[model samples]
Target: MASLSLPQVDFRAAAAEGAADARLREAVRNNTLRKQEGREARWTELPDAQALRELAARIKQHTLENLDYYLRQLVDAVRRNGGVVHFAADAEQARQIVLEIAQQTGCRRIIKSKSMATEEIELTPHLERAGLDVVETDLGEFIIQVSHDRPSHLVAPIIHKDRRSIARVFSEYFHAPYNDDPPALTQQARLFLRDKFRRSEMGITGGNFLVAQTGQVCVVENEGNARQSLTTPRVLVSLVGIEKLVPRMSDLAVMVKLLARSSTGQIMTVYTNIFGSPRQNGERDGPQEFHLILLDNGRSQILGDPEYREVLRCIRCGACLNVCPVFRSIGGHAYNSVYPGPIGALLSPLMFGLERYKDLPQATSLCGACGEACPVKIDIPRLLISLRRDMVNRRLSGKLERLIYRLWAWGLQSRFLYRVIGALQRWDLRRRADADGWIARLPKLAAGWTAQRDMPAAARRSFHNIWKDRH
Candidate 1:
């Protein structure tokens, strides 16, 4: 198999061109709105939604505060259950550990469930580099894998692609008959991946929640593909973020209730599999070996930061993505990270670097919809603002922006300067206004704002001036 290039982070280019496609915009808009409606309908049906949310948040906060205790307990529990646990401080170590496991097991072909953790580590490329064929079993993930594209949404990876686009991709890649029917497309993928599953020596997946009390990993998915990936193979490898741990099995109830409803708006996902360990003595079907890797990959740093620790409380429900106006307009690709949307804007910068992902914080409209929609009640807008402040404090912002802000602050501090500036703005507006009283073009720094939009000219007279005269 040929090696495929994974997506790179180029927010500037993606925002400029990748998001300009009308079809892509329409598809994202339509799909996200549908999910939002479904979420609203299902969310309203719950009697104590707010209470559940608060409970979930508190549970997460408690777990995070004592993460070390829970993680050690979790490791001991997994070992007692005859499962192996590995801790990776970064992505390189995580990938190397998985590779070592595969080589030791002599596993060649691998089947992977939908795992953002794996994506974060670029696992597929690493495995493929070692001459292993790794297949993504989820339908959405499969589409993205075959098309050589990154996921545009968390729950629905290929939400940006319409049926026609998928059909085209299938026809071109698989040489299958040209059909836009949903079931047909699904069947085609099923038939293609069945052989891979049967031949796969190992199955890789991401855990939704790690139950520390039972040492069990809970995976939630709408499709049975994850089940097949974990069970059909001889070895099962689960890669989970360190933040996914919950205190007890009973706590899963609150998370499970909020997760499904907030994500796809289902009463419950099709499969919520919990695996404590490999196949037991009496078990008929299960992996012979179970390996759980707890990945830190910048999460520990984020956890240490008081202001951003709330970000780890995310359930990966994608509700925030569905409600974010910026996400709706530009889609996930614009963020250019494994995670996208409001949560992505917060997580990517913290996980990666503030300097590299500076634009992510600026992408929001500060509408607070993401915070309102979050099942765990993370204040996403507050985090975005905090990140912006950090940028300014670090002097990461450009000189021009600093100068402009300083000038505006100075003008506001002096009443005479404020009035003079206002008068100058009115004079400029009068000079620049066209017949329609619109500024079609702006000079220098402000030109970018008017590139795709018209700026309304200022009012003919200031309200203060008119009020003063009338009095």
Candidate 2:
């Protein structure tokens, strides 16, 4: 593996190019099975998976319904535990709040765990621009950060690349000869980041679930980067989306059980820690200061909307990405947002508005792979159809498409005209047929269709036409 310097545009372009055709479908088909089989084996090995999912679903529903009460309870609990609480209406406010804390503490270099909420706010860019050094401690995130790249996968940011690529990125960032082997690559990153961990001024992380019952923050990860990040510094900040709040500490068991099986197919992640407030006096090692910023950008909007409220049930599991045909091909960047799969598609529109994401909704084949793959089972396809309908009703669709659909409706309304048109189309195809039973290509608007596909040579007799004749 050579040093793969990941330029953002190039990375996004490669992903966008791959998703245009069959190769995108093939890529997802391959990875999806690996993840699905792994999950099935893990779940089958433990009889607790289905029960956990049902329990987790109920817990999420309960929290969502009484979110106001639970969020207030979570805040009080955190305060009781001596953790400061910050409310951010959107990303900028969240970033500003974090930066203000860092400045107030006179902190410069900060270490962080993998947190999608932090990613949603893009904490690194904000902190770096403010003259602070922020290092990602998670192995996958470390690979991406060192390469200066955006994460392609939610769980495994480097899933699109192999060990060879990992070695290359490490070699370049660490300025040492790195091996392409897995163990060697892992060792190099471990050694290089260890020093950063021990010298950090502050640490930041995202919470998996915030227990309202005990005002505890929970995180699950294969690597101990999150643990290190949360414990290494004087000021520890945990950024959690408002939707991550769960009503009770007991509910944590159910969600955690479902998390691993639905995600990487493990009975449990290698590390699961519940932190209650900052470390107390005589504690061996932990942060001296703690803060939890609960962000509610567009989440509150979803809560108010009847049609899109279920979007909150997302547990940040990447199952939808593995089973998504569109995501596999284009990866996440093509949507031009943080989220890049079925979940991303839904969130991007809501967060950024659908008008800006013109190509996203139409990118799907209307297949229900995403919904089927989801652990909580979000109805993605139905939402997509609803968005399309909304787009059309808003007159956001192209005029030509509206005309075509109207003409199609009118033609189909009269059986006599429909048969006459079908008969003419078949006659035209017969007249144009040449040697080899092929017409090579068709004309104008129809040419694009036949360019990659031979539009079923207008069967000598149409299905409806033949049915009538036989009767």
Candidate 3:
């Protein structure tokens, strides 16, 4: 099989275009703010929310440290429970593993719940290429699939789209009557998917947490579609990242509390399903064959790196994305990766390589909002800084940027040069400033920063100059 091409994202270009879409901006802004507010309200009501977050972080840290042991225990537990497990080293291997299973089982129609792992591997396209019909059951994912679009948010895939847009998509594609109301659209989608669920021969899902002790895969979702997908099909396949393992079943409470509240601001999701193995004798409804594919896909490399291992602690809550200014402005598609936002900025480059995803690390302002919003307390801004440092050390940054930074560092080290540059900057700013002391446009290298917004002129005198005079 040919290698999958990495998404070529011109972040500057995509962001410029995305910023122009008022409708998309409005939807993203409204949804993100609402989720943030809801999360804050619910988080505050919980006594010792900070302590819970800390505990969750500690548990994740401990699990990651002993990941190999936990993974072995999980695999053994799964086998003991009558479920088969497969290890995939990369996306291609993962795709092949699933394809082989589908071909062996003669599965034509497959139902999939919302799974970022499946998205990460680009499994649906691979399965479709082999002549299988795939349907996404999540309401948001279903809308995105029908519209031939990618998910714009982690939890809410269609966060960039409004109800009116969805209604149009339904009318255009499904030939359904136009209705913009939420209930009517939901009902229409539910009716359409119910048939697919019943007919699907296989089901694919992503596990939120893999329990080592009980060998169970936990999936949390607001919709019941995941439950249906897992139980309705004859064959079930779960593709989960290696980092998703937890030490035991008891740890789920801490993660559950963090995940739901952090992602959707719900005290508890509508459904939290834990599946161990296929249906045994006398058991009904579950799949006949249960397959768990533990995907590495560069995650093991991350696990080895102490600086970035905390990234694995992320519960996919999307709280960081909600608080991210860059994500809010550009949206997920502009990141040009399956994962987006602050977490994506860090993970994409780490998994895909810094050279291929060089621009991703620079996509942030290092505002630290992502770190603050993160339930597991992954220091996203710090990770971003580390990626940038790696880029600089590898000389991946452009010559001009490296040169400018070298000069900046040199200037900062020398008091005389710093004062000279500061004075020159103030003089230049004063020259360009209008009567209102606002520079609407800047020249050359600085123009991009000023293009979108005005830059305030520098003060008439430097703080150093004023301090020197007063002394």
Clash pairs detected, candidate 2: none
lDDT of 1 by residue, 340-440 (tens): 99999998889988877899998778999999999999999999999999999999999999999989999999978988899999889778989889998
| Model 1 stretches with alpha carbons more than 4 Å out | 1-10, 469-471
lDDT of 3 by residue, 243-266 (tens): 999988789878998898998889
Tell me which residue pairs clash in candidate 1.
Answer: none
Candidate 3 off by > 4 Å: 1-6
Give the TM-score ranking, best first.
Answer: 3, 1, 2
lDDT of 2 by residue, 320-381 (tens): 88777667666666666677788877877776677765566767897897887677767888
Q: lDDT of each structure? A: 0.90, 0.80, 0.90
The C-alpha local distance difference test score for the whole of candidate 2 amounts to 0.80
Worst 10 residues of 3 by lDDT: 1-10
On the 0 to 100 scale, the lDDT of residue 445 in model 1 is 79
